[model samples]
Target: MSSSPQTGSEPVTAPSTTSLTLAIIVSCELMLMLDGTITNVALPMIGDGLGFTPAGLSWVTNAFLLAFGGLLLLGGRAGDILGRRRVFLVGIGLFTAASLLAGLAQTPWQLVVARAAQGAGAALAGPSTLALLTTSFTGEHRTKALGVYSSVTASAMTLGLILGGVITTLASWRWVLLINVPIGVLVLLLAPRHVAESPRHGGRFDLAGALTSAIGVVAVVYALVRTADHGWADPTTLVTLVAGAALLAGFVLVERRAAQPIMPLRLLAERTRAVGFAIMLLVPMVTMSFQFLVIQFLQLVLDLSPLQAGLAFLPMAAGLLVTSRTANGLLGRFGTKPTAAAGLLLLTAAAAWSATISTATTYLGGILGPMLLIGLALGLVIVPINVAIMSTVDPQDAGAASGVLQTTMMTGAALGIAVLSAIYAATVGSTSAVLVGDDAVALGMRHGFVASTVIAALALAVTLAGYAVRERQSSHTK
Candidate 1:
């Protein structure tokens, strides 16, 4: 490597060691990302095996999402205070053990509990990878490492759909959870040998901030998820929403006073990072909603096998991988604002087109085209969005910023699914209607797609407006 100093303040390591570190981090991240959706394809089988009622079945996914999203800020702060490597190992071990329990679960409740444990572990481990990257590599090495990280994240999600299908098809839904055990074990073994311990800040853990924020988010997510079974105006839903909002407000107050807040308030005040966070929250909402609805449409409406439904996403993944470089080029040449705007516009169009799918719609002419567009849109926007989120933040707050971004992503996914499910339910008239006919289900899916289109259009508008403001500010400063 060249003699130029690395971006991080840490001392440089041997190239071979650096390579190993990257491998370990990327693999761990892939595992984490995969779990977010792998269970989706397996949900039907899992529900059948556990004899879950329709309402209870959603917890299989929602449990993990709520825990993971709610605790991310605390986890990132833990890495900053207690050391990233230690937290990472702890997280992997917890997650691995939880996976085993989930695989062996005898009841729906057991599986849901195990899934929540896995999410908690994931929250601890996920942010550490970014923290490790910030402190480990420098120069061209850092760029390459980050690029690989982003690509793996984008691809792993779709890969989960495929992997979930294969396992659930040939073997059992239990294998979907079981597969993670070995991967987690392998990562745990390899991590200590390759990854260096992060330097710990002597700051306090900010337990008050951690607890309040986590609980607040969990409550909000719980309320949202319940809306599928109970309408938004239900007494329990209203109470939970009010409680969640109050807790979150209290969290903000706690953070403002706490010496070592899990999330630094100052980070959110930055214009570019704030905008990035908003976009990150909204984009994932659309993508996750799309994935959830489309997969169901393929399997339920078209009556495709699990394997076929999983394999259907291959084109989308391929398109995303192919377009990633072009996205990076666009970011370099055209800038974050315009490139992101264009990408979101494409995504909006894709969402609109997807809304047109019906029970009679064929894979070739309807689904495949939208999937390709979704992939391309993902490639064109994600990296630049990351750039905007982190570019202006202080180096010392990297962990916190990363934590916030990740938290938003997970929360957005959970919220989107819940909201979309509600829309799906409304369009279908009732749960009874959903089970009555495929036509009702198809109509519900279409409604969900239209809602996602609205979300994408809003994101596109945000990108355009935020960048315009940024440009105006730059000119004024000049």
Candidate 2:
């Protein structure tokens, strides 16, 4: 295995310009993250305006996710080979053009296609955001930058919901997508001036590995999305799932043989980094599932309007922003292992607490406390885990590493939604006769939260166990 990269140990940019550089990177990251959930609150409005059928409406969101998740690895590697700043501008430009297309789209298919294009652009840009941050800042500055980045990563979805509601209510649903035009144009204009380009690593691009990985991820994500509509036993689902797995296996083989692999296996060879990747995968599973279930609970059971439900997440957003800002201090004082464990512990507890909700439960009674705790837990967990994975990577491979991290996150989100949605569906289907009305839905949501609790607990176990083993090995060597 190759040794960890030490490039991040020192700053790449001049100290005077680091803050401006950070703002640019963070703004881009926020834009990407916000898009992940911003359209959700506006989906009904979009469907109505576009005359979408029930099943077809979902494609508006799924198309974006499928493309984004599929191309992230390729995007990251492209940044490494071609130059990050250049690729980032290309991505932002494409995304801006696609956003305009989406806002102007007359048909459902056109909108879906435009959304997919936007996702492709995001895939190109997403990895470089973190790659640039890791390369540009060092020491306490890196930690602080990561803290701000993590805060955006964790809270952006909730903020997106809020923003979507406000935009859709105050203006039209088109504005939700159209709003990106100005932001993207501004970013495109300023990025070249403020963002320093990374040194391009000279290598033969791993074409074979890239094709297999991208196709494999898209196939898998499509299969998972299908599971919400078709059962796991459906022939199409099984075929796609198997095909995706085979393609991914082929990608591994190709990567291993390639002279300059798109994703170096060496990155995962280190125990800490591998564990960090696993935890990142698992934590997102819980968070995405939690969000999905809670949104349903607020809208279906509590009968809140979209705007009200979006505003209800204010406390969680506030908590995330506050705690994420402070997480760097916690990490400095307690170190990555303990801080991560504590965060996971809190996440597990919050998921469990959320699982106790019923039809009778009020927002203040069961949801508020857990939402706040979830915010705090995510801030603590995401920042340290990001530090663990990115801080140790070789600078040359930072783009690839960032891509893998994001791809893992996307896969986890898809897996979580698929798994929890299946469970909830099964619960509701079986209990439909026994329970009446909102009670059945509440029970299903509770079951989904229960599953999320288990997922969080497993992540906690892995984190603690991984650290314990490392400590034991250290003592033995001593």
Superposed model 2: Cα runs more than 4 Å off: 1-16, 47-59, 106-108, 424-440, 469-478
Candidate 1: regions farther than 4 A off: 1-16, 53-55, 426-436, 469-478
* Local lDDT at 7 for model 2: 35
Q: Model 1: per-residue lDDT, tens digit, 12-124?
A: 43234467788899889999989988988876566567776444555777788778888899889887777777888899999999999999999878999999999999999
Index of the highest-lDDT prediction: 1
Looking at model 1, report the run of 10 residues with the lowest lDDT sum.
469-478
Taking the tens digit of each residue's C-alpha lDDT, what string does model 2 give over 1-478? Answer: 1122223233334223458899999999999888877776776567668875433444666677667777888889888777777788899999999999999999988999999999899989999998888777776677677768878888886798788778877887798899999999999878877787776666667788878987887787667656656778999999999999999999999988888888899999987789889998898888876775676577667877668777877877887887788777777677677888988998999999999989899999999888888888888788778777777787778899999898888767756766676667555653122122588778878888888999999999999888663221111110
Model 2 poorest 10 in a row by lDDT: 469-478
Q: Residue pairs in steric clash, candidate 2?
A: none
Candidate 2 CA-lDDT value: 0.78
TM-score per candidate: 0.92, 0.88
